[model samples]
Target: MPSKIQKLEPDRTTIAIGLEGSANKLGVGIIRHHPRPDKSSPKPPAEILANIRHTYITPPGEGFLPRDTAKHHRSFVVKLVRQALKQSGVSIADIDCVCFTQGPGMGAPLQSVAIAARTISLMWDKPLVGVNHCVGHIEMGREITGATNPVVLYVSGGNTQVIAYSHQRYRIFGETLDIAVGNCLDRFARTLHIPNDPSPGYNIEQLARKGKHYVELPYTVKGMDVSMSGILAYIDGVANDIFGGKPKYTDDGAEITREDLCFSLQETIFAMLVEITERAMAHVGSQQVLIVGGVGCNERLQQMMGMMARDRGGAVYATDERFCIDNGIMIAHAGLLAYETGYRTELEDSVCTQRFRTDEVFLAWRDD
Candidate 1:
């Protein structure tokens, strides 16, 4: 077992290197954070020394596999690490800790990056920090947008949740009971044989912009929880029938186009998401809504969220694609925050899992 590491004073500046490979993307980032003595004072700026990422793209109509994604991470993680260190102008000796995503992701992919992080920690003689993926997104979003204690709507291929911070814990107000929102969109893209070069969801969004009409699809919102699997199934059937030269008319005899389906899907799902997010904000009495995770980059979703927040006399906050998508900067930023709070993952205890929940991590850094 690795020896117990000593805690550092929170008043000093700390540097952390974070590795993220919870899914198809592999990222390496370095961050420097300066903590202030006064807890109520403004949060000090967290500098991004280096932030680099690479994605593994599969063919159209295909989803990424665990083994393949792991291999992809292992193959490029070293190169990314080297590049990030060089880009950041920081040597291994300058880093105070190494961090990695621990869970709520693919088991093999998470394991692959965790192994790299553990090896790096031992090589550099730095302590290890385990980061939660969802929390990483939330923290990064807050830092970039300066949304203090906002309602977070985290949407990605693997997760769709409405969250609010309370008692130092990020509580989930609502989430998808089945497949996530991004997963639902990707599967529907596969049914339509859409290319997955950049992202299926991106392609769908682009196609949606060309649509002038809407085709009806099931909108499954059970109170705060949503059921996207049924909607995906229905859309997939519609896409298959349309592609198979079957009747392409709605029940009202209106013609159904591919663009129409995409538009309708985006409108329906995004509206559902906005509804749940608004509900969360109302429940928490928060005026700000912050959207995080990969799918949060969607413009239509942002527009819908903005409208909802405006209706409630509130505001919506979001980051660009760089921070919105899963990246190393988030993990690095979040991990450094934890490290300052005296949280570290010993080498022997840095085991990665596939089911780590966001609320599992104790919040020692936040006073609110």
Candidate 2:
């Protein structure tokens, strides 16, 4: 329970600073807006003022290691913060509130973000708001697609789950019991000895596109949960067939080709997701479907969801890398909305957590 929603004049001059530290990416944003009454009340919502997003990519071989990620975050956060503020044309002194991710991410990365926000909040005398990272991703997707109450599929390197809004909170309908989908993709890329350039996920997708023949990748599903470890093993076993020793194009055997494996893998994985999403939509009574998080940028994934939505007479939505792939703007957008809801975190309450389930966040930031 927090402050009661109160009515105020149509505000045209309010700005909020947002900090996102859920993953290795340390993002910061500033948003300007006009103030308004309770969004859930009879009053309408406020207008946005200014918005910004910044992401600091972790150096190679440092993404999953928490200690190394901490160093990366601490080193680049201050500069990024100033850059986001400068780009938004907003002053830290005038920032009405500060927000940062509190959990559902690496503990070291979370601590890095929390410490930065807490330090700034104390120095600026601004109230701090702690937000759930996954929730931020979902809200950002909603803003990008204008999809309300859609079945949300959150897929990232560290997390993968199917979710939908219910009872004033996002409820997890299905998730991986052991490993995430993105993690599997990255590991598969490693098995194929693909250059981990740009992004491993993208690299795998490209190789999959050139591949031909159904590689018969494993597909394991129990109820609503999926296990991709078997699929990874199967793909590794067929690596030699999919990727040849020389770089030259050699069409030798029709039994297995890179394009076929890639196509089959993408189709199988996407079908699993689509199956669960359709089930979740049926259960939630929602027609809209939204894809968010880092993996949401995959065109193949989006296409699968699009086909699923069309089959169900629904609509599928997703944001590009701008909002979908772990950025500062989404964090800031979600933070601004939560701040308007009268949600702020005291310094003592702002502790970084290794595990914060998405469904656990209450109605503090939601509107009826």
Assess each prediction's global lDDT (C-alpha) against the native: 0.90, 0.74
Per-residue alpha-carbon lDDT of candidate 2 for residues 1-368, written as tens digits (9 for 90 to 100) = 13334322445455677777676566776766554455454433333333444444433433447777777789888888788777766677778778788877888878988899999899999888777889889987876677877999999887889998877899899998877888888776666555555677777788777766565567787777888878877766676544555322335645555556567777787788888888988987889989998888999999889988998899999988767777666666777677776677777888978788988787555664
Candidate number achieving the greatest lDDT relative to the actual structure: 1
Off by over 4 Å in 1: 1-5, 37-40, 250-254
* TM-score of candidate 1 against the unseen true structure: 0.97
User: Model 1, range 168-275, lDDT digits (tens) per residue?
Assistant: 888989999999999989988888788997899999999999987788789899999999988888888888888888958867777788899999999999989998
Q: Which ten residues in a row have the lowest lDDT in candidate 2?
A: 1-10
- Candidate 2's displacement at residue 114, Å, is 1.1
Which prediction has the highest TM-score against the true structure? 1
Model 1 lowest lDDT segment of ten: 1-10
* lDDT against true structure, model 2: 0.74
